[model samples]
Target: MSTANRDLALKKIELVPGKRVRQKSKLLQYIWFNRYLYLMLAPAVIYYLIFHYAPMYGAVVAFKDFSITKGILGSDWAGFKHFEYLFSQDKFWQVIQNTIIISVYRLIFGFPAPIIVALLLNEVRARLFKRTVQTVIYLPHFISWVILGGILINLLSTDNGVINNIIKAFGGTPIGFMSDETYFRGTLVFSMIWKEFGWNTIIYMAALAGIPPQLYEAAVIDGASRWQRLLHVTIPLIRSTIILILILRLGGIMEAGFEQIFVLYHPGVYSVADIIDTYVYRIGLTEGRFSIAAAVGLFKSAINFALLVLANRLARLMGEQGVY
Candidate 1:
């Protein structure tokens, strides 16, 4: 609203009685006007409160020598003991290194994959072919990682796997993509890209759809080529979305697909593929070290939160609307 008009409205509201009381009435009326919208939002708000925020109370388990029989609040306080031991472990540092390296590999190779695919799909004039391709690629996103992991094991198995069979047919050596430490991380990255990149492409495609046709029309009139139009127009319009998704991704740098890794990793590939989440699962859940597990989970949350805030701050400094 214009400053003058807003001041005029406030003056009219103030003339009714106590200025603050009238202002409060206006705010209540605004809420009343949008009551149905708020009603629609209630379930989502309640979900987060119950499933996300309420469980935060259990984070104290990280600081306590927690016993399941004793419960969270009844446990003896261990102060920083859990965190101290977590930091002291050389294995913990190796896990951290693996996590960062895997996350970086995803960021470098997997991040731009969707953008490239979305751009290519956007340029395709054959709608039938495009739809077929989209459906084929997006199918994996709906399937559970367990199923995909099994399929990948069979497809890439060193002992007469389909891929190895093809290699042998072509007079090439059978390489262990999943079992060999040299190829394990790269295989993880490739499969990750193949599995989820299409889902991300949907986001980019949505953003591309929102671009005003008039902008493209203007570029065409100005004798711009398709590449020029994309560079000067399409990318600039979707810049905020790219920035927002990137910031959210940075926030989850500690996560390296726990489900996928858990299903696919074995002792042979653990050195390269084991991430922080898997380590926590081994010590915290399977080994029943509740306090240490809670501590590691809390540490991961703290790092993610800090990265989110930092990424948002940097995005705002760079004049982009980051995910707030």
Candidate 2:
């Protein structure tokens, strides 16, 4: 309470121990031991530093009237003009709603798909079959969304498309999956799951591999069945990994597959399918509303950063290792 007492309390607090000469020497020794490996990683580190970290400097454009003629340095300061306009736009809220709906749907339906696939793969007795299935599923993840979108367009096209053909054969009405507002979101969510679920499963399978056989042995000895052992031991052990992934997902709350939306979206479904990233593209590049786009991007990034911090804090409170 008193200034002197406060000063004394501060003085009493110990500083964190720094790396001493011995520790420094040990670190150097370890580094030198794997010098070649470090050398291999150097280019990637430098690339990220130059390309990723350096570009963050250009975020200043959000506060300026960025002009090709003036350049970033000579651009006129606009203060918070873009930000104010961004909030005033009614479509901004619509884009945000679309982003949230798509992202939340993906989280609900797409997130667990890989986990289920991994579990099923783990249960398979035949290694060859499991590997084959994994390979087939993972192959889709490598295909570019541009190509996949084309395929989806043809397959879901209203006029004699594969899906429509099947629907007609079943005496059902042909639905325009891509252009229809009702089905557009569902199609996007399902297509994303189909594309990435297998690749996502790899991480969960790796985590499953680290699970000790001894736990299962103990469970079996205690008269636990396979399902019970899975429920108790396997799920519980991988719970932290799942939570960590969920927290990381929360960090990207505003990002709802830019590539997917850019490729799949059409004018008819734009109301429901247009997300923040797509809106930014149209405004910034197409409409030449550079500052407005920058403002929207900044807002998205700020919310993502805030969500990341909150999610990390929640993870820590739940006794899990957070990204921080």
Candidate 3:
């Protein structure tokens, strides 16, 4: 190569490194300028680091004998022994079926409840009445499942509960709402909707608030009725938010509300109410079968992660922004 050509190539290479250096310097300057924002975010970052990421290291116990004495690292490797035992148990399959059934019931009824409530609330003309209704409905969400479970048990008691009294007044037999397998799943789905629908509406309501008023005005000018405005203007504007929430719901299909089921279900209803989370808790905490429980949990996490990715991809394909 000629000296002139070599010099030209050297200059170009020098400029590339200089450009990268300048870009990095700008990034550092931006971070320094926004130091306070990062400082505010530190607690959340530290929390996830300590609680979430740190515990992930212990997931290896799922593949080990998992002796508390031997420690996680020193535990003997057992490969897929625990997983094999998990799948071999008929009870595990029953729990899996129950989990899916409950989750599907929640998805069908509970998922749409909030949207319907939000839409109805948006249509209300009286602001004071609307706020009162919202406050009343949202109160259930703040009650812990342990307390709510006791309240439900009392309310559904066959002897002297309010519901049974009304049933007896109408010459109908009082039903075992909590104990009967036939009624247990329905009770769970409805109770979950009652507890969470109002709280979930907050997001939908915020999304509705973001819709442009001019869109509704334009629709009205074109002779659209209230229903038509909602269908065309309101629904379209909030479609992305709906899709995002649906994707998140789909991601959690394996997790069928551990606290609610654990608090409410007795052995009589276990055939219908026992889900993967509850099963894992019993096996791991109560029976000391940590390896088996860890295997089940790891499997659940894998399926959830896959579902999340698939749902996100499908959302993006449908021209909606997904939860990345």
Best by lDDT: 3
lDDT of residue 280 for candidate 3? 93
Best model per TM-score: 3
Each model's total of backbone clashes:
0, 0, 0
Ranked candidates, highest lDDT first: 3, 1, 2
What digit string (tens of lDDT, one per residue) describes model 3 on residues 269-322? 999999999999999999998989999999999989999999999999999989
Q: List the residue pairs that clash in candidate 1.
A: none
**Model 1 agreement with the true structure over 144-180: per-residue lDDT tens digits:** 9899998998999989799999999999999999889
Winner on TM-score between 2 and 3 is 3
Candidate 2 versus the native: TM-score? 0.91
Model 1 reaches what TM-score against the true structure? 0.92
- Candidate ranking (TM-score, best to worst): 3, 1, 2
lDDT of each: 0.93, 0.92, 0.94
Model 3 alpha-carbon miss at residue 17, Å: 3.1
> Least lDDT summed over 10 consecutive residues: which range in candidate 2?
12-21
Cα lDDT for residue 306, model 2? Answer: 95
